[model samples]
Target chain A: MTEPKTAIAIQGLEKVYPGGFRALQPIDLEIYQGEIFALLGPNGAGKTTLINAVCGIVNLSAGQITVNGFDHCTQYRQARSCIGLVPQELTTDAFETVWNTVSFSRGLFGKSANPALIESILKRLSLWDKKDNQIRMLSGGMKRRVMIAKALSHEPQVLFLDEPTAGVDVELRKSMWDQVHELRETGVTIILTTHYIEEAEEMADRVGVIHKGKLLLVEEKNKLMKQLGKKEMVFELQHPLETVPPELCGKNISLAAGGSQLVFTYDTLQEDNGVTDVLDCLKAHHILYRDISTRQSSLEEIFVDLVRAS
Target chain B: MNFQGIKAIYRFEMSRTFRTLGQSIASPVLSTVLYFVVFGSAIGSRINDINGVSYGAFIVPGLIMMTVLSQSVANASFGIYFPRFAGTIYELLSAPLSFVEVLMGYVGAAATKSFVIGIIILFTAGFFVPLEVKHPIWMVAFLALTCVTFSLLGFIIGIWADGFEKLQLIPLLVITPLAFLGGSFYSIDMLPELWRKISLANPVVYLISGFRWSFYEHSDVHLSVSIAMIALFLTVGFAIIAWIFKTGYRLKN
Candidate 1:
């Protein structure tokens, strides 16, 4: 398949803090335009550090980052102007009205004040009603929406949300996911970092797994699930068996419930998948089965296995 | 470059000042008025005159300088420091502005505040005693210079400070004390011998002396030296701020 246009290009980025903690280790990745790329990692897995480095908040120890073809270091204003970041912390100015705070963010990027655009952004985030309210007066979810409004105020090409739904309730998280999908429809390349595996499964087009400052893998979400996701087929046997039938003994097969059932694990990516072969072997051994069932492992299971192995 | 970015910070700081008018404007203006009422009248009744100017008039320029210096430091420092303390500086750090533009915005707002306050004190002093400015141009020059210079100093202090106490520490312990001893209330000529030389070493002395000279045509130091000292201090302040941004000291890793 032809590669999509690159929105953000990170080349050999490395960050070793002053105290010698390597926050990121030579992470080289490219995020395509209009795709929801989720950097999924556990706590202390350098997700925040990586986002901070790209946003130019945390200075990178080494490497180059180009945002929309502009070198981040050499042309910072042009590069940073194309990106917006909603930090993990809710760090709004408490006394500022929602309208002013969002306007301030737009002004920070050298953009002329466009009240109508800011109003539209707030309205889209369902925060237009609270435009005159002080940030301190809003609830946690409103403040988060205000953050998103501020990030979108400047009309950036790429939006980086560091754990956007971290502390949100289930209902709010779903709404936020819907908002993210809407943003993607508007042609904003959204890169979010989250430890919520289900969030990645729900929202991301591509997923990257980072652990111990190292980026282990980056792949299309559906492709990753298909490649690593294993399927288990269980056979309900009518009679107990001492062990797996000799015909299927050495295969990716096993017995369960004290031989009352036979379990065979297979990869979906494989053309044969051993489904037909397992049934033939069971019949050849005279192991009668009342019924059969198969189940596919989820992305969560694949993610856990990848992290554990690394 | 990035004029809008500079204006954003400048306008934000200015708005904060207006929002906290009680602490930022009213408090300083009230204290300066109290100083004029107490020192101008009480001392004017006794000393009568200093270097051919009435005691009340002689202290006018001094009072304005003192208030401007301290307010400049306090305002600029709090303007930047509070954002850092509140964790909102990430927005600034991640903005498209260069460090110079940011400085222009913050220091510009701070200096404007102190300048306005200094003018208020100067006008209030006129009501207490008859005043005449020997050179109004130089008077305005000194007032503006003092405001800008001290605001720059405060911006540096804000970046260097990590905690709230440290922010208040410099203005309270260092700036306030320096203004008190820097000949704001008395001329260095009044000090006998040893103390006179000691007072000369205070950098704030040059600021007050130059400003006083503009009003009464009398100063302890030569005009050239005072102008040179102010210039030197301004250059140093810019150099330090540039270094802070270059090294990303206490701002970024």
Candidate 2:
């Protein structure tokens, strides 16, 4: 299969609303085929705006987007035909049956009716039994699943899930992630925007962090953690200290648990890590510890720092 | 170009019409029949004829025009409006649907709905008044034209409006009143000279008059002018819709 490697490319993309609101700054991003790319951003960080721009739902102020090597503006139909967007809003035809709604979405992409394909999708989403049920009658989770089914009905190579699990229950979220992984295995490139740091940690091959209308960084999951991660060493002090000693005050050290523990934070990427020097300094300062434990920073910590710093 | 896409949207809208039969079909039909009963029997008995034609028969074309105009606009405006309201418009926008295809599906289904109601109202009016068409072909032509034209107007209204009240604004404050004054109940010819002069300015006048001409070959305006007005409305409506699509107004951003 000589399929293109770049599933979607955004170059110098910018969006400025008429009211002088700059929703997105000029940015460049590329999502490859068959990769789970997670976009992490807090509210109003342009995560949805970026996704919408590529989906052609939001008009771009500048730059160009190409999906499957088709220009999103000049070659709109082809570019759009390659994308399936599961919008943040849980919107569906309230009166329509699940089967007809999904089938209709497929047809909108110019695909001929294929009941077998539609049936398989419904079955896969665990919605086969409720296929005849009106959308209004389905539970919230089922409705979201139907949205996913409708998006996939067209069989687009790239799927954009904007906050797919926003209001879903934990179990539903887990099942949804499982379904996403299954879809990824079948060669669908999934790009999801989420506030759940654990989701990115668990699901993304590559993670992009955006803040205040700018994409701060895009990196492999492990690489991001390694590059920016830190480890904290906590020493259970033999005696509670009312204050830090003068000599140990300059380093990445702090007293925690109301002075019951002395915490030393160090960069994981640094070679020395300074754990030995810290212990020696602590020993020399008559700072005795009962025990010591080290823990690496989670993705959530890194994400918070990245956004907070910017 | 995307025939399947158009069909899917069209079928979905048509199915919604069926599902809400009372609101979509029955309400308009029943309302128009009520109009025929009150105006045709009550008003017609008081005023025997308007220019030689029986009042009951004379008001038929106008009544049909009234029902068709409002129904077409109401059907189409709400057809597109509901999708926007429910936010499912994102599905259509993000899909591979061209603006034309989306418009075709929505406008086509809406026109068909109103056309069906128009025919039903025509038949319902027939029971109230003994009707005859001097030019049956022109009658059908005007019926289809008015359905499509007003439906386009409704489509425009759907895009232009943001609130539920705005959707009903033009249909009620503008369209209904225009229809009443546009010679739906009495001809502009029957109005005082000053009022008649002002009445010609109402766009609905041409629509109802042209439609009436096809009934008894009698109209306030010349048949050619009536045809011209229909063509003008169709052209302008098409242009505005094309502009909306091109600019992606209300659909994209």
Candidate 3:
């Protein structure tokens, strides 16, 4: 068997289109077995290109990719068989039933027909009711579920969900989150790319930020938020203020909540982020607060700052 | 080899054909009946015998060959093309399959489809024409080869095509007209000396002539020459398909 820990190892991976467009720069990274790694990026950020390169959908210009110890190029069969990809586009055979298409995916991966496995997958995705229905007749959310079922049909070691919930509704997206959690329970290494930072924050154990064909940073999701996160202090006031106090007018302090609260934004990493000054000023102004709460910057804010700074 | 993969693709393609049985099977059979009515009944009544074979019997092999060739190209071309157009080709590309295995799945299904249609036409022709096969083995051989070879040709066309219109271009502008003028209805020998020599340049003439010979044991061209031409087309088709896979033409990039 291959390395027991590393699910995927990509070294010096690059993709240059025939038209001379450089889609991926030379990069090296490794994903550990059973970890959910979210590659976060905006549109045209080479996230899909990198995923496609490793999945054998796009031939790599240069690099080595090994999935479960099989080289993606030299041992493509073993490597690809171990990897399942749910592309962003909802492309499926309109005429085929859900069961047939999902079973067909298993066969495509070189697995023998296993009706039981297909049944289990369909049932898991809540698609058992629609298994016999044609793809064209299904709702968009159900089709997405079918795509996931197809990816899981072959019992792959690694699953790549490319923008899995790109246009999905909130309820379905929440259900999909549960599905991802369940897949994690089954010990499948999941790597997904998305511009939706909330998805990364909610689903990822680790997050890799890719921008302009380059991997900028990869860190534990919580650690990443803590490292770059800013602090926002909101004080619920007992009295209303028409505007910012003259003493706090030039500071990062503002009136909010219909003048019933005072908000302060500051850098958490700074030795002194003016929080004391703002508090002192509020006290001097005889501002009595009913409650005070601090909120850390979300992954979305950190991601925006990272992309903007880069 | 990914035997399961090939079987899956093959089964999927065949299922499509069965699902549209009217267009895939019944349509070809109906077209064959129409050809028999128009050419065999109407034209045969006015024309004299060629090489002592009745006009109705003379066109059977040609008709079958025509149907086989067209159906093979059409079936194979559409089978591959639809997956590409629909963007499901990504699954095929990402699958654990060699291009050869993929070719086998698609081309095998296409050839089988054309073969079935050809047999149906042959069986349907018997209802209208007094058919006789002097060499049943060669007839089967010719029919099988025509199906396989033309399907390979169609597979190539499917890959080379970027749009639906291009898929029909070669079959319509090239194959259909060539088959019509390839002595499917009349022998090339009945033409003027210069026209007969020029007709020799048309490859379909050899295909139709050789097919007709399997029934009546008479042909405008030698059977050996016809076999050689088919072998050449198969080699060319296989070579082109190999090159396509190697270069990743319209398939990968």
Candidate 4:
């Protein structure tokens, strides 16, 4: 099949500060049009650097980045006009009214004045009530919404949200998620870097994990889980036991909590021979369990494991 | 530079400066009044007429220029510095504004501030001593030229400065002292030959001489020479600022 058109194309992007600090190595990635791509990484993982370099906030030491077929360095105005960036920091003109800030941001992207569009954006972001209020007077979450409103005011085809909901409340986060969904519905390609793994799990169309300035893996969320998912079963004994019986020793089962509980870890993708053999071994050993529970690896666990392994 | 972008940024910056009315406008007006009261009255008594004009009137142009210079520089420097310190420059850098748009927005706002303060100081000086405008058009032209030149200088300063202290260092340590020693209060001709030669090295002397010539139609320096020097300073100042913006000096990593 032919490759899908890319909204953002990054190839061999690198950033090295003047003092010789290498923030990002050469990275090649393509973000498909109209998809929500979540970039997952730990702190100091060069996520912000990559985002800034792509957005032209930082000069790249070496790279070729194109947004919507416009080269970031050569056709910067066109490239930047086609993209909207919501920065990680809560930085706004303190004295500017929310309405003016958003409206002005739209105009900054060379958009003509459209009060109706600006109002709709403000209303969508729930900033209509605070339209006349100075940004300095808004709460942190409200300020973040203002940032989103500003980014959306220009109506760019691609949006880069750098940790958009880092310190936001749960309700607001959900609403923002809904907003992202709505934006995606409207065919806006969204790329976001998030510290909240659950958010990535819930909202991302695809997940790209970066570690130590390297792209570790990029895969579909469900596919990644299905391929790498592991399951663990725990049995709660009716009574505390002193040790695991010798008959159960050959099986991959271990005693826990002074032999009160038995634990078994197995691959979920295995077709057979997991719980049956463990149960058979338990029955042969005359082990009893009041209850049993199975747990599959969550995205959080997968993320932690990936980071640790890297 | 995008005209629309420049307008947007200029409007945004001007709104910020005007939002704090007491700080941006009233305080500068009040401060200029105080300078006229203290300097115009006390120093005017000690000295006689300068170039056939009252000592009070002689220093009026300089005092106004002083306010213009200091306020213009401070406005531009702090305007850019505060955004950098607050980390909001990222928003601007990421926006579609070209470097020229950014410079025009900042320098235009700074020049507006200086022009407003210059007018306020002129009005304040009017209350202390009677003054005459020999050439009103020349006076206005020089006033605008001075404000724009200093505002551009301030733009360069803002880009070069790392912090608030560094921002103030140039205006306080360098620009203020030079303006003071540039014949703001008296003619450089009154100084001895060596001191006069040294004062000639101060660039501000040309700015003040050009402005003073517009008012009294006579100055210690020739009008053509002062105009030429002001133009030269403006060209050099803008060249440096343009280069800084183009290269993103001290702004981008």
* Model 3 TM-score, all chains together: 0.93
Cα miss at A105, model 2 (Å)? 1.4
Lowest summed-lDDT stretch of 10 residues in model 2 chain A? A1-10
Model 4 chain A, poorest ten-residue lDDT window? A243-252
lDDT of 3 by residue, A268-292 (tens): 8888889889989889989999999
DockQ of 1: 0.78
Model 3 CAPRI rating: high
User: Candidate 2 or 4, higher lDDT?
Assistant: 2
Tell me the deviation in Å of residue A93 in model 4: 2.7
What lDDT score goes with residue A92 in model 2? 91
Q: Candidates' TM-scores?
A: 0.94, 0.97, 0.93, 0.93
Q: Could you give candidate 4's per-residue lDDT for residues A1-310 as a string of tens digits?
A: 9777899999999888888988888899999999999999999999988889888888888879999999998899999998888999998888778999888888788888899999999888888989999899999999999989988989999999999999999999999999999999999999999999989989988889898788888888888877777788999998887876777766677888787888888887778847898888778777788999988888888888999999
Model 2 CA deviation exceeding 4 Å by range: A1-4
DockQ of all predictions against the true structure, Cα-based: 0.78, 0.84, 0.81, 0.69
TM-score of 4: 0.93
Higher-DockQ candidate among 2 and 4? 2
Please give me the DockQ of candidate 2 compared with the native complex: 0.84
Worst 10 residues of 2 chain B by lDDT: B42-51
Residue-level lDDT tens digits of model 2 in A1-310:
7864999999999999878999999989999999999999999999999999999888899999999999998889899999999999899988889999999999999999999999999999999999999999999999999999999999999999999998999999999999999999999999999988988888999999999889999999999999899889999999999888888888888899999999899997778888889989988989899999999899999999999999
Report iRMS (Å) of candidate 4. 1.3
Q: Sorted on DockQ, highest at the top, how do the candidates line up? A: 2, 3, 1, 4
